[model samples]
Target chain A: MQWSTLIVFLLLFVLVTVLGFVAAHWRKADLNQLHEWGLGGRRFGTWVTWFLLGGDVYTAYTFIAVPALVFGAGALGFFAVPYTIIAYPIVFAVLPRLWYVAHKHNYVTGADFVRGRYDSPLLGLLVAITGILATMPYIALQLVGMEVVISALGFPMSGWAADLPLLTAFVILAAFTYTSGLRAPALIAIIKDSLVYITVIATVVIIPMQLGGFGKIFAAVPPAKVLLAAPVGQSLGMYSAFATLALGSALALFIYPHVLTGVLSAKNARTLTRNMAFLPAYTLVLGLLALLGFMALAAGVDKVPQYAPFFKQYANSFAVPALLMHSFPGWFVGVGFAAIVIGALVPAAIMSIAASNLWTRSIYRAYINPRCTEAQEASQAKLASLVVKFGALVFVLALPATYAIQFQLLGGIWIIQILPALVFGLYTRWFHRYALALGWLAGMTAGTAIAAHLKFAGSIYPLHVFGYAIPGYAALYSLILNIAVAAALTVLLRLLGVAGGQDQTTPGDYRAAVPDRDSGAGDGQMAAPPTL
Target chain B: MTTRQSSSGIHPRLWWRLLLLVPIIATLWVPWYNHLNPTFIGIPFLYWYLLMWVPLSAVCSAVVYFKTRDLV
Candidate 1:
């Protein structure tokens, strides 16, 4: 093992852990509350919010996978770049309204919003279940990236040594997250984003020069592997899969529980709006990372060393890690690897918190006990967060690696189904509560089935649906079907005199700035919390 | 409700719309795009992808900025 590289890596890891623990005292707030532990006191300003959301949206997977795909497949991998660019405009128009409504009602999760909007606990339960299901695997995918990089550095894991790395990463993650809440990841995200920026910029310049310049690298790629290439008898449906994936992914970005957690944590709608407007800048880095895919292909880097099982190559996926180790100096490589490893922890921590909040507020509180105290709920949530992280680790360990990648994509699909309840419900409560439930069911069922068919099919079908080769990405098609079913059911239910339930807040609620308008007190709620 | 329009934004809009052209041009650098002769600038089209992405991203992001800025 490269001890110099290993030394640098350990230093970064220790630094991030220290930041995680210190983040608790950084806010110096009441650590006993759910808002403090889970949502970071629900008070991040635009700068921290930008880094937090940016770090969340651009995961270690984006750093690892996008370029890996580009390296393997060619032009198709660039789709993630455009999807991110377009995502902000969509979020800008929708999320502020959500923040307002959720804030006015003191809602903790999307399930809370859905439950109140449509007056249906059942619908809220479905949203909660889907959120927990989606987030668990998505969090695990972050660990997969960390495990890949850690294993690549040849970290020896016999019993606890092997398990200790992941266990340690998660425990440090949980400790800071448990102690500081949302602030933990927000603080560490500063390190994650800086390391990522430095590494990507350095590699963008360094790798091409090392490999005989731009001309020689492209010249090395075989014609068959270009945009039109297929592995042996494979066809060109991959392009369709790529396009559908971009579309589905963009639509899904805003609905994830983690995305909503970031939005709701903001100080105000203006902050959320401003951040969305500027967030696309991060995609420039993503585009650079995606290009590494092509670079890896050009460099002839494939097949991870046997000792490093997690570092194996697939186009657009493994490109960044492979190319960095292949091309960069050892110290810089250590920094880049730390960025990916730490990057994984930031999202993993937040995602677990988001999922845990759903378990606490929506599932346990609603179903198990109606009179649950806020302290009880907060305790349950903290425990749930730990369990969810470990559960995700187990899933990541049990599933085949490729299947795990598909699970994150599946996470995107499941989360997007909540759009009508969260995004659309922000605008109008016209859809009957029963209709929302029906739509969610239809979308989940159809999307999962289509995705299954795409994954399992033996030969050519009319259209590939949802990365499954039926027609389109299952997420896109099922979403359309879901929306249509939702609209149709809403009309039918309303026509039959089904009430949409009690909307506790009115149209004015979507524009409300304060938790309680009657006081008009000079509370510091609107002002940014001092940076810790 | 009001719609706001500004000319400063228009130039960025055009730049954004036109930015697509740079990648198309850069696509020529990768060898994969070279069906006719299979070479440009002595670098295959794939190698040029990294180069093209840096500039292309600038244009795409500029468009995003123009589209979302507080012009109103």
Candidate 2:
């Protein structure tokens, strides 16, 4: 029954639990302050920021689902690599500026940055609400990642029975995240990244060897599935769809409030720059993980004796785990499963903290209690993190685990709509605040409607206009209309003399670096604005 | 309520900003490289084409990062 494997996983889980709790005191900041609790005092050094961000961004289901796509469909799954490739350079272009302005204004969340930049509370609230909605489902999907591993561990229960153990695992995650905030995930990222390295390496090197070689693996895939040629005729969109999916997702990745939380928490601009330089190493790992799907196919996973029964019932999401369970001994199977489980927990911690920070900074303080102090903000965010995690739990329970994938897909599309008001607004304020909001509305509606119309979880939807399929990703198509609407409306609004609201940022603020002097950085720099 | 200013060498900013186009524009046209007839160690052109850009993107970001560090 693999009890020994279960015990090994439990031991590692216990070790990470201790680390999560101890992280509350890691940098020794006053935990009562919102910045400290919500952002690890926004002082993560280079390697810490690397691990924390590496852990936060490349999530758990991604560890499973990317490979699952390759296993099920073939080369199309490799889109994740190009998407990630463009992502770092994009980060290089704009995120440092975001960090600079966010730090200058003592803004703890992306919504707070939106509020300060556009000087519009309603725009900030829209960003905050969108961030919370996108992140909640995403957090729920992490549980789905963990849930797949738990069910794969020889427990074949379905429906409500499958979720009980997951609920328990999430409760422990919620407890530690509530107490420790970003620090918990920062410390746990170390363990998560280490195990991910071991898992990806094993799948990439060992499985290929065991299954003959990559030559034999590619040859084993049916010619149609493995061939890279884009089919001609009405499916011309397939070719461009591949490229645009990567570009669109790359644009969307860092805009997630959780991603911005990681970005904003770095000690300074250079840390972020260095992180972008090396974060591609994680992309390298992702490439290897994507190859694991091919490895699963080559290994003839459905034919493996141990996994044959489960193979008949489940989807390709279990391919890598099944490969591990089939190849490695039970204890290593436990270690691999533990890696996936820990991977989910790390992001769940960071995302709840990021989401709750949005709730506290942009929603609660702006609406519920305008007079809230620093300590109150921290406590409110702490309490809100639990609520966010609880919401994630309910989301996971209400939607079938299968539908959980739809939520994850929707997150990328939903979060990208905020770019005009949130990201482009970083570089130029040419976009009027209302025009930005309208852009967000058009983009969100188009993106969500297209995704929902397909009623499928994967990215390929033939965008047929007048019965002719167009070549593009859903987000890219929406982004086209998003910018068009924002630009045209911006010119129209400016002509009518609509006030663009106050810009609380200065041009110099974008280029200012944190001082080399370490004293009183981050904690004492916050100056409350009179206008808000 | 204070403003800080530092002049950038227009040279480095211009260079790095231009460097960003290496990945973004290179990947924009996918059909150019979407062939598998020329495989690399059993990897298709489609897969290796994208993987090739991963390191390139990193190099571009690293260069931009160093160039911009002086401003911040």
In candidate 1, position B28 carries an lDDT of 24
Give the per-residue lDDT of model 1 (tens digit) for A366-442.
99987987788888988888888888877676655542346577777788898888778887787778887888899
Model 1 chain A weakest lDDT span, ten residues long: A523-532
Off by over 4 Å in 2: A159-161, A228-231, A303-314, A398-405, A456-459, A465-468, A513-532, B1-13
Off by over 4 Å in 1: A156-161, A228-239, A303-319, A454-470, A512-532, B1-72
Q: Residues A19-70, candidate 2: write the lDDT tens digits.
A: 9899888878888998888888888899999998888778875677778778
Q: Which numbered prediction scores highest in lDDT against the true structure?
A: 2
Q: DockQ of candidates 1 onward, in order?
A: 0.11, 0.43
Q: Top model by DockQ, which number?
A: 2
lDDT value, residue A26 of candidate 1: 77
Q: Give the CAPRI class of candidate 2.
A: acceptable
